[model samples]
Target: MSTAAHSLSSNPWKQGAKDALPLLGGYIPVAVSFGLFSVQAGFGVLETILVSAFIYAGASQFLFVAMVVSGAPVWLVIVMTLLINSRHLVYGPNIAPYLQKDVRWLPLMHLLTDQIFALTLTRMPHMTPSDRLRWYVSAGVIAWLSWILGTALGAIAGDELIERWPLISEVLPFALPALFLVMVLPRCTDRRWTITMVMATTTAMLLKLFGFPNIAIPAAAICGALAYYAIQVRPTDKEERS
Candidate 1:
C-alpha cells in the first residue's frame, strides 16, 4: 500500500482496542443481563459463560435461552439462532474485501457480531489491510472478554438483583433490542431506509401473528433485504421523472 496507508496501519491493534472501549458501555450491561437471564432460565454459571463464549451472538443467545425456558424444542432454538444470526451474512461481505487472506479469518468469523460489525464498517475502510485485521481482531477480543466478565457477574448476582427489584427482571431482556432500535433509528432518516425498516418489522410481526414466530426473523430478514436491494438497484424517482 501507499506510505499513508502504512502509517495509518501502525499500532492498529492498540488503536482498535482503544476504539473498542466505548462499546463496553453497551456490551457490559447487556452481557450481564444476558447472564442473569440465563440463570433465571435454569442455566448454571458455567453454562452461561460457555454460551457467551461459543455463541457470542448477544441477541441470539438471549432468544435461545428464552425459547428453551418456554419449552421450545431444541431444534426450534437452533433454527431460531441460525435465523437471527443470518444478519451476519450481510455484515460479512462488507468487510471481506478489507481482510487479509489467512486462517486467522476462521476465528474472526466467530468474533463477528453486530457491535464489531458496525464498528468495522465505520473504521475499516480508513485502515490499511494489516491494520484492518489487527483492529478487527483486537476489538473483537476486548468485546469478548468483557462479555464473559459481565456474564460471570450477572450469573453470580442476577438472582438477587431480580428478586429485590422485580422490574429489572422485566427490563433486562429488552437491552439488546433497545440497542438495535438505537442503531436503526439514526439511519431511518432516509426514506428508503425508513421503508425498509417498516417492511422488516411488519413482516416479522405478521409472521408471528400467523403462528410462525420461530421463522419470523429469518423471513423478515429475507423480505427486508430483498426490498432494500430492489430499492437500491432501481433508478430513483427523480431520475425516472427526469
Candidate 2:
C-alpha cells in the first residue's frame, strides 16, 4: 500500500471506531429499551427518535420521559434533566486536558456521554492532541448513531416485540447498568479509583436507604471525588512539606 493509504488506514479515527465497536453491544439494547419505554409511556415514534437524536443522554432521557408521562411541569422537567446531566460538568474537565486547544468544542461536548467519556479517558492520554480529537469525535459519532438507530428500531417495532415476548420487557431495563459496569469496571484497577468507587457506591446506597434517593448520585459523586483527592493528593503535599 502507498504510504498515504497506509497512514490513512491507521488513523486515529479508525482506531476510535474500532475501540467503540464493543459499545454497540451495550448502547443499542439500552437505546432500544429507552425507545420502547418512551412509546409505552405515550411518546410518538417520531418523538422517541427525536429524543434519542437530540437529548442523546441515556439515563436523563429515561428520566425525561418518565417525568413527562407523569405530567411534570415544563420548568420541573428542565431542571430535573439538567440535574441528572450535571455530571457532565465533571466529565468535561477530566477529558479536556487530552484534546487540542483549537478542536471545536461544541460538537464534541454535545456528543459526550458516560461511555464516550470513559473510553476517551483511558485512551486519549497516550495519543497526540490532534489524534485524540479525531478519535474522540469518531467514537462519539459512532456511539451517537448506534443510539439513534436503536431508538428508531425500537420506536418502530419494539411494542409488538414486547407483546410477543413478554420477557424482553423484563430484561431490557438491566442492559444499561450492565453496559455501564462493563465499561467502568476495568478502570477500577487503580487503587485510588477503586477506593473512590467504593466510597461513591457506599454513599449512594446509604443515601438511597435513607430515602434521599433523589440526591444520591450527585452526593455520592461529590463525596467520592473528595475522598480521591484526599487520598491521592494530601500525602503528596505532606511529603513535599517534609
Whole-model lDDT values for every prediction: 0.80, 0.82
Worst 10 contiguous positions by lDDT, candidate 2? 1-10
Worst 10 residues of 1 by lDDT: 175-184
**Candidate 1 on 12-89: residue-level lDDT in tens?**
888788877876777777888989889888998999999999998877888888888899999988888998888777
Give the alpha carbon lDDT tens digit for every residue of 200-240 in model 2.
88998999899986667667777877887788433667688
- Among the numbered candidates, top lDDT falls to 2
Q: List the residue pairs that clash in candidate 1.
A: none
Model 1 residue 18 CA deviation (Å) reads 3.4
lDDT (Cα, 0-100) at 60 in candidate 1: 83
User: How badly does each model clash, as a count of residue pairs?
Assistant: 0, 0
